[model samples]
Target: MDLLPSAHVDAYPREHLPPRDQWPVLSCDLPSLAYPDRLNCGAELLAGGAPDAPCLRMPGGEVWSYDDLRAAADRIAHVLVDDLGVVPGNRVLLRGPTTPWLVACWFAVMKAGAVAVTVLAAHRAQELATICGIAAVGHALCDIRSVDDLAKAEVPGLRIATYGGEASDDLLRSAAAKPDRFEAVATSADDVALIAFTSGTTGRPKGCMHFHRDVLAIADTFSAHVLRPRADDVFAGSPPLGFTFGLGGLVVFPLRAGASTLLLEQAGPEQLARAVAAHRVSVLFTAPTAYRSMLQLPGGHDLSSLRRCVSAGENLPAATWRAWHEATGLRIINGIGATEMLHIFISAADDAIRPGTTGVAVPGYEARVVDPLTITELPDGEPGLLAVRGPTGCRYLADDRQRDYVRDGWNLTGDTYVREPDGYFRYVARADDMIISAGYNIAGPEVEEALLRHPDVREAAVIGVPDESRGQVVRAFVVLRDGLPQDGRTGTAEALRAFVKEEIAGYKCPREIRFLPGLPRTPTGKLQRFRLRDLE
Candidate 1:
């Protein structure tokens, strides 16, 4: 087997990768996990599948066969190489909604042997700038709808190409001049394929580096063993392609099984149900909050075509699960996954599911509950930190916080959980200040920082408050500058919310703003988040 042509030795992704000693030990016991040393995941995922089979069903009733997707991806790969001067291992930042073109761009990056750095479509310029800077992204493919944010990011020397834009900016136009067939680069199994930057407890996000092998590993492990799909199945989901959860559910899992996926730009509760009905989708993946919201929708959405529904990104409340089951006669398959590990590590399908518990670890993965302080294994039924290790595990890119996440050999998923005697994992709470609201990870300090940017706010502290619909909502406690009108409470709160929305993603803005005389702090001056939760 011939090795892929090497990129510059000074590639930032390779240069900034964590030292060998810090990487979590990878394991693959499944027969499907046996992959070739010279593997191109894009070739495996896009080119070598059933080319004539239906692969992507667009929102407008247009269908694309596997061959169609492959041809587009190959052309895009050529565009990257010839038009954009992209070399193997160059970091290509992708910014767009989850559409067929975006999916095609992702596969194209993989086929070109470039590392894909995908950020959520909802991210503002500041977030985009921080991520691009951290990942050292030099080239970008962005949707025209999102090009404004990319331009606002002002990344240095970033070569920008547009897709879903005007004729002059369209990537497809560039690719039209190129051949529609391309041979994917044969890269080593351990080569970094993509960088998924997940939000941290602090204000910054940490990039989790995954390999070509890890790309196939998640599909072989969780998707293969747990959420098994047939070639006839059509998958659809809400999470953005930037999130690993969305990437796995929409792209990897379906494509791995030679199935098709329906890409939806907006997959809220009502829209999701409509998509299921309109597309006759067979497999559904979304967060728990979406399930709860859909359960409240007026009953005209035909969901009889859906055989499976997957819930993740946050805990599935037993009540919400039962409600969804009673409404649809389908038990939502609950799972727990992290950006670091790439996809779901624990999940149960159909009859094997227990209402409140995240079922046993998926085949090819191992998990345990450990004492948060000592890092020692804890007995079942005792709440402690959840540690997981498998073919995919934590690999932070040049972040010192890697030491806190990976201990010994286990990836401590900053989550508190209790394992039942039957091997079921029950979610307790988050071990850190990071808040999971409506399936998006919102750092409290990040919200506080946004709020503080407002002139009217003297001091601000943000925390997650329990909510039935959103799972949690961001609530801010603020000490306001003295001159504000007390009678204008409604106006003031809305003003602060709008102000924060300008600085950050609208989803992270405070849903409720309460002006307080002072925020609760410890004697040592540490913000007492627990105390704020009690007030809620």
Candidate 2:
């Protein structure tokens, strides 16, 4: 891969990209993915809609026109360069719930030619600090309600700016004084636009660097060809913009199609149903858990407005798919995407879908089930590792784990799958110790690390257990220190759960904890996690 001339003044992101030879095979066979050398995705996405067309809508009946969003993004871009001293390639951290203003901030970062590092609002101080440290973040744009956690992160010399607040120094207040028109930076298509972080089974997060062109490649391949979104569609979802699944469904896909989206800050099963009916949302993106829960809602919901439903972040069971189609005449599109690949690569929609399979590779992508050791393609009906390559592939930020993810021009997603004779990829199991509970990825070792921080815990092991609601739930087996009260086990379990919550995100906390005299270990002193699963 040849390099393109960059417009970035600060070159940290580019300097940290993995060696070009280690990158997965990238393809752009589709006509829509042939982007120009000097492209700004922020300006491109805002180009199609009419000036007065609705671009963003809130649950409270507030709507922002295309012109309104463009102007706000332009003003914020000016504020980034002039007020915050931001230059191209500087990593700017964005921490906020899903809202119109958060989307505007993302566009502003792109327009200013800076790399956006979007972390979830549920991330705590330790998680935020780890991400900021890895990305070398110097500035943060945080919502007023979510500023406290970012403020507690130990990133020295970090410049923090708050938004959606009445403070005099708020980001929106500063933008109010700036002009509503600014020229977007003429960045190369290969310039880093965002660095999304994903947890590894090793209990550390890896930064996935995606180029400016990768953002639009997802829309061209999956959204354009498969989802077939129309300009009149109204998108709504429960994913926060920090996750790529949410970012594409809520922001990129709709904006690229010149459609409108309803942003919800707190979307539970009931809240999602009400908003869909009230706003007439036609397209929805959420996990299978949400769909299952919505089906059990009291008196049911008026989902007649919905035409398309997308399920990702975790596997969609055949039972859930059948139940949803039986209730509402809409077929749920199931996709499997990684933070490294940016968005979905293998998915099916409409008549092409199979109940239990994850469909064939989307247009412009290739997938195969390969033997993990030799990378040889496996025969039909044989379970092996799932490997894929496409226009957008894994590019870790200078991590040695790059070799583990990308091998022989293919990205090996740590999933075990079996390919049917007809080419449909069937769902199997994860080959790693990652726990997918209610659409969130929880690393077992990471949760175990949090549990070990307690003085009472002598040893601990975490594993994912099957659940009816969530696909899987985190369960922990702990060996306490000497002389602990054995009769008060129930109270100790509650106390341990509360202790773990303070150290990490509440969602990663173990739902069930069982006391053990000793964790299963080998003679070589290595923990045997397979024994833990057997105990479950």
Q: After superposition, how far is residue 379 of candidate 2 from its true place, in Å?
A: 0.5
Residue 396 of model 1 has an lDDT of 88
Question: What CA root-mean-square deviation does each model show from the true structure?
Answer: 10.3, 10.5
Candidate 1: the clashing residue pairs are none
Q: What is each predicted model's overall lDDT from 0 to 1?
A: 0.83, 0.88
Write model 2 residue lDDT over 239-337, tens digit each, in one string. Answer: 888889889999999999999999999887788999999999999999765786688678878999999999887667666688789999889999999
Lowest lDDT block of 10, candidate 2: 519-528
Per-candidate count of clashing residue pairs (backbone under 3 Å)? 0, 0
Native-referenced Cα lDDT, model 2: 0.88
TM-score per candidate, chains pooled? 0.81, 0.83
| Least well predicted 10-residue stretch by lDDT in candidate 1 | 1-10
Q: What tens-digit string does per-residue lDDT give for candidate 1 at 1-536?
A: 22233433336676777776777767778888888778888889875358899898988988889999998999999999888889888899998888888988999999898999998776788888888888888999998888998899898989999987677748988887789998888777767899998853255999999888899899898888888888899999888888888899999999999999999988877888999998899999987657766765675689999998998887676666887898889989999999999999998998899987889899999999999889899998887899999889888888998888888888999888889998998876667766788898776756776776575665677888889998989888887755665333888899889888898899999899888876664211235567778885
